[model samples]
Target: MGANLILVANDEVASDPLQQKLMKATAESSGAEIRFFSLEKTIQIIGRAADRQKIFIVVKTPKDVKVLVDGGVPIDEINVGNMHFAPGKKELTKKVYVDQSDKDDLHYLKTKGINVYIQDVPGDHKTEINF
Candidate 1:
């Protein structure tokens, strides 16, 4: 996979030392530029990278994706990443969890012709999800 640039969620590089180190190595080796931006700025960044290949946006929850789609980010297929367990959340995959609200967000995405799936990380088995 050719990674040209990586846009990390704001302040994450400092808070997540391990991830920061990993991404730093990746950036150094792959010549990928890493920019830290707020969630609110994702749409603008994505808009600029629209013509680029293999753009990946990672968010904390399903609602974030719903917000992006609602705000007009044209996401067609989204793979749910590691969602830590919480009381009202249902486990879709061992690493992925969702509450009813999360399910509603997914359903909304599906209604918009956006495919959804479960894949906690790269190289993991991907499972298509339908509501």
Candidate 2:
């Protein structure tokens, strides 16, 4: 059987320390690898997959990244979000930030029936927005 691919959302880091610790320990024990990265970092790692047994532990929300889907990795498991399908909708726009100007994420969401609006600002490498 192939190795497992695990994705842990960032929100779980502080609230689910025990589970995070256990996953880390287990991956280390099995000589498998565990990577804890932001959504961006996780996507970067996914690009490096080359048939190795890999597990990605993302302590962040799930967003669209080319590497996650296009990378050869099966992306067998992704653990994110709360019990609610749309958690903290009202507060999300305030809490999340767009770290880079790249709109791959925006495109991904739009394709999935989500709406996103972007405003151009001068000299803004990372566009800052309330949402």
Candidate 3:
């Protein structure tokens, strides 16, 4: 079977037609079967053995990553992409910016043995927004 790519996000992303359209386009290009879920549903699915092997999850925020980790999701690594820079956020890399809380969360994940990387997508390096 093909791998499953799960995208978990908040209501803002769920309600945005453009975001939805873009997600679908990315999924199509990736050749993986893609699914969208609310954080609640994602938490439920992540613990299932049958669903774990072929799943790659994409979450919007560091808070969301913490939620998944707290829910006992077996995430060994995470790729963070499309992050937007805001005032008061420190630049972690060319594509990543973090506030104190975000840094804390990333540290927590690292302590829990999860590898986190800045995902490099085409055109992402060209923009300050990183979106």
TM-scores of the candidates are 0.74, 0.34, 0.77
lDDT of 3: 0.70
Evaluated against the true structure, the overall lDDT of model 1 is: 0.74
lDDT of each: 0.74, 0.43, 0.70
> What is the C-alpha lDDT profile of model 1 across 1-131, one tens digit per residue?
46566666443453677877786786676566776555668766677774565655656678878778877877778887788899988888788888889889988888899889987667877798776
Q: List the residue pairs that clash in candidate 3.
A: none
**What does candidate 3's lDDT look like per residue over 1-131, in tens digits?**
24555454454675677787788887887777666677777777666637455876777888888988887767887777666789998776766878888878877887887877664854443322222
- Higher-scoring candidate on lDDT, 1 or 3: 1
The number of the candidate with the highest lDDT is 1
Tens-place lDDT per residue, model 2, 7-122, is 55343353566777887887666455554544445555555656654454443333433344443334433322231224323322333433333234445544544333422332
TM-score, candidate 3, is: 0.77
- Residue 73 of model 3, lDDT score: 69
Off by over 4 Å in 3: 1-3, 9-11, 15-18, 49-53, 119-131
Winner of 1 and 3 under TM-score: 3
Clashing pairs in 2: 8-58, 9-59, 9-60, 10-59, 10-60
